[model samples]
Target: MKVTEKTKISELIKHSPETIEVIASVNSHFNKLRNPILRKLLASRVTLKEAAKIGKCELSVLIEKLKPLGFEFEIDMYEDSSNEKINEVIPNQIFDSLDVRPILNQGQDPFQMIMSKVNILPLGKTLEIISPFQPIPLIRILEQKNHTCICNEKEGIFSLFITKNSNEGLENNVLEKKIINKIDSFDEFQNKISTFEKENKLERLDVRGLEMPLPMVTILEKLEYMPKEFALFVHHFQIPQFLLPELEKRNFFMDYFIVEEKEIHLLIYN
Candidate 1:
């Protein structure tokens, strides 16, 4: 198959399993793809073109590297999107904006950060998503949930203007309304813990739809500064298999419960 800018990383891997080594060898950071968690969360969503940008490698160089893997990219696809300005684009008018490039820079998935904000966005309010590269997969997901969006590319940064699709009846598909309402600060979150410990307050970290390592990292980091009596609550979309062992190693046990078939809650404590 002819490689194009829109060719997803997972498709490339599926088409030719050898492409993984070629992509990883292209840059040190791309080596994260070797991890199953990263591959599962990112590979299906990131395009080859976006992969090159994320890897901080020249498009031409990445294209050349792919040649050995039986994939050939067109010359036009080699033109990096960063150097070109996206013209005639009118972004959605948004008062609130989120810049998740910081999270990406820290080697964490910014997917949930964007979704979390979007979940609570009210009528007539717009959410601007700022990222290092075009977040195509997320845009597609929002589109599925019936959100209208406009995309813009300036220099290397991509901005997406998002608003709930009125035609779709303003449905919040990714996160439940109860969970969105449940979102609170560290202090407020502590007030709503399980009955297992009354004296030991618990903080809630709602990670619904958060990608792999980000959820695990956020939980562990919070645990570091937490009081010995404190517990941590997690609202997740799925079980974090990778985090279970880490919690066990720290002598913390987790209790899981599902609510309304839409949200899963986990309580972690020593």
Candidate 2:
């Protein structure tokens, strides 16, 4: 049968008792059915929209539950060149008008203080933010809590913030090494972040002052290797909503604890 909009694969299976044979035949050539969940969904004989909803819902729940632990979760939305659709859906201008001073002025808050001095710029049509480590005291506090912390720099001046959870004992030497190691060449740093995520050893990796192509490329790579049992703590400056769809296309996944200055959002992807 010709696959058309009105025809539901799930319905086809339900109507055909030999559906399993057909599915097996197709799966033999393409391994998509190797995934039990996907196989089950296909076997259910549901509409393609229903199957997609199942996948989206599963991912959403996973991301939500991972929020408290600090994960960077997102949905990927797509659009065309008119810029009208993208702007209407995921407005890039929000960062240009974002306020940070108030968040920074919040008394004795570490996340707030760190975000205050950061600057987010537009890279192409995408938004980017850099939050560097400005307050030494706050760094010490996070380190004392046994978490991994990162500070970014542009022209030797601090500019971005990213962190990961850690259990290592904090000595200045250890903390310094962790931060320093995260600064391998921009490419290396990005690769290392993915490796850390894959290995579940990622303790807060922050990228700053890197040029175009680097951020977008790394973001794509990061999504590909997103860990199932890790949380990402990020201080949002200006990031894109389309990142999620980009990741979805590649089957990328991640959960996030995104602190935009002070307001916190938790994201989980199952």
Candidate 3:
């Protein structure tokens, strides 16, 4: 069967029960594919196309993933060329910038301020918005207008780059880090994360600013050395919808909290 955006998850699973693991390996949320609640609640209603939009995944990537899982579908190479790449970045790429952290800390909404500034830009200009965290909701709004966004979080700061003339595709895929090293000396829980960050344990594999397959591959590789039972904290622009199932298959448990919608703290453990 040819897989299109409208291909429902239930139909895919019905094609082959074995596909559950196959598709789940591509994302974490799909791990819940076996859950009665999710299956009954969404599997039937959610199509692959809708899932891509919900998970912020690329349609082409989803189609490619299905191929290895006994899903023989026609490949539409040019079908994705028009899409913008939202993950990979060119260091020091020039752009117009706006910082909204201060406005946010003052209990003011920066939306209007940001729009006021962005609206004045020349056509095809790049607008860089720095914030406290990755604004997934905001990006969703911009995408509807044909804008491309590259999201990055560093040292508690989130940087979002929006461009009108986009040349690449979006990379929302992520990984499971293999080297989950902890601080040699345990300090208070609050200080523990800080120490690990300083020790580079947390920085060892920052999947942020990386593209697909690279993200997923990096994560699976890291999971190899990550300690079982000890919590591992990861920062991502958005939830790794595809990677969730792979983590579940590995017997790992995870829950995430968003840091002002700029950065997501994915806490993973056994």
- Among these predicted structures, which one has the highest lDDT? 1
Instruction: Give one digit per residue, the lDDT tens place, for model 1 in 157-218.
Output: 77888876544433333432222232225443344563535764768788765554466666
- Superior candidate under TM-score, 1 versus 2: 1
Model 3, global lDDT: 0.58
Listed in order, each prediction's TM-score against the native is 0.53, 0.22, 0.32
Per-residue lDDT of 106-193 in model 2, one digit per residue for the tens?
Answer: 3222333232322122222222223222333344454454433343333433332323243343232322211111232445435534
Q: Encode model 3's per-residue lDDT on 1-270: one tens digit a residue.
A: 666666788898888776667666767746656554345335665667655544556777677777777676654544532224433333334357888877655444566556555566555667789886555445644564567666655555767787765323222222234422223332333465565567555523466666433454566666667765355676665566545545755777655555656455565666
Candidate 1 positional error at 81, Å: 4.6
Candidate 1, overall lDDT?
0.66
Model 1 Cα shift for residue 130 (angstroms): 3.6
Lowest lDDT sum, 10 consecutive residues, model 3, at 167-176
Give the Cα error of residue 80 in candidate 3, in Å.
Answer: 19
- The Cα local distance difference test for each model comes to 0.66, 0.36, 0.58
Model 3, C-alpha of 198: deviation from truth (Å): 58
